[model samples]
Target: MAGLAAAALLGTAFASTDGLARTGIFGSPGLTENDTSEWLNTGAPDFREVVESLRPSDLPLPAGRSWQPVIDQQVADGQREPARMQATGVHAAFAHYAVCVWDGEWLAARQAGDTARVGRAVEVIRGVPSWPIFVENDGGGTVDWLRSIAEAATHGDEGPIRQHIRANCTSSWIGVDQ
Candidate 1:
């Protein structure tokens, strides 16, 4: 049931982004089957799912593009409908891991005192869509945490945020490797 719901939501999402022809397994435009698997398995979100979660068919954030506004808007909007953010492994789970890996990179760069990489990581992390995380529960708090953690990456540490993401997101539905 969860997988079917995910498929339906993805079908609508794909159609909204492009057309019916794009609705397929790992058919989120630039994201290939191999790319999706590699990214999810490694916890590293590529250009597609990280920033382009809502519109996978579109290009990723270009150089110098800031994800602050998008993040702000998502946090404000709070959680979406269950059908819209189906709690499937491919979806909520994949998105969760992508965020974890992206933030993990930021925390690592901060620990290593790599200012440049830390800055770059922050930019990337800001784009992660929070809708999937909402699938784990409800309220704008989930979204707010994502934004706050992105900010924390800039000025403080995010080890605790990682624990929250992991404890909340353990991969359950479709599209997950486990």
Candidate 2:
């Protein structure tokens, strides 16, 4: 999966100038040239900025409804495009952070036992442009890995997630076990 170009995925667009996959925003510290020992040791980087960006500035969840409406409005308004994602190291962070925020919403709903909210979150995520990048090959089509991952995370089960990380890991600097 390393060095995959935008063309590798049908209709997918990569912002990389070299037409190669670049690391950052997607928890690919191992794929980076930075100090591996130092970087990996710090664990996952703080993504508060990306999470905060998804918050509605002037809109709050109305009454008993979920935040999906606001997120949907943002999407329809073209405000949640990939170019609007966290850009600490990416030119456009939408592709990366959209997954993060959606995963968070999914997990939160699952944990709260809110089946309706979980379904709504999943529906919202279905519209995210970058979601296709998270799919993995299966027999007939592809697996929506993010949904499985969110399920795993909500259950505090890292085995499946680790298997995915190792199987798809393209970085040599940091060990998948790390």
Predicted candidate 2 versus true structure: per-residue lDDT over 1-178, tens digit per residue: 2222121211222243332212243433445321121111111122233333445332222124344432343243322222222222221123333344444545566667887877765565444423433332122222345456656655656554455445543223112231
Best by lDDT: 1
**Model 1 misplaced stretches (Cα beyond 4 Å):** 1-89, 129-140, 165-178
Q: Per-model C-alpha lDDT, please?
A: 0.41, 0.36
Residue 30 in candidate 1, Cα distance off native in Å:
33
Q: After superposition, how far is residue 90 of candidate 1 from its true place, in Å?
A: 1.6
Write out the backbone clash pairs for model 1. 89-173, 89-174, 90-174
Per residue, candidate 1 scores C-alpha lDDT tens digits across 1-178 of 2232233234121112322222233424254221232111111222223323543222233333334444332322222311122223234433544565555556556677888877877776665534443434332355666677766666666665555445543332111221
Model 2 lDDT, residue 40, Cα: 10
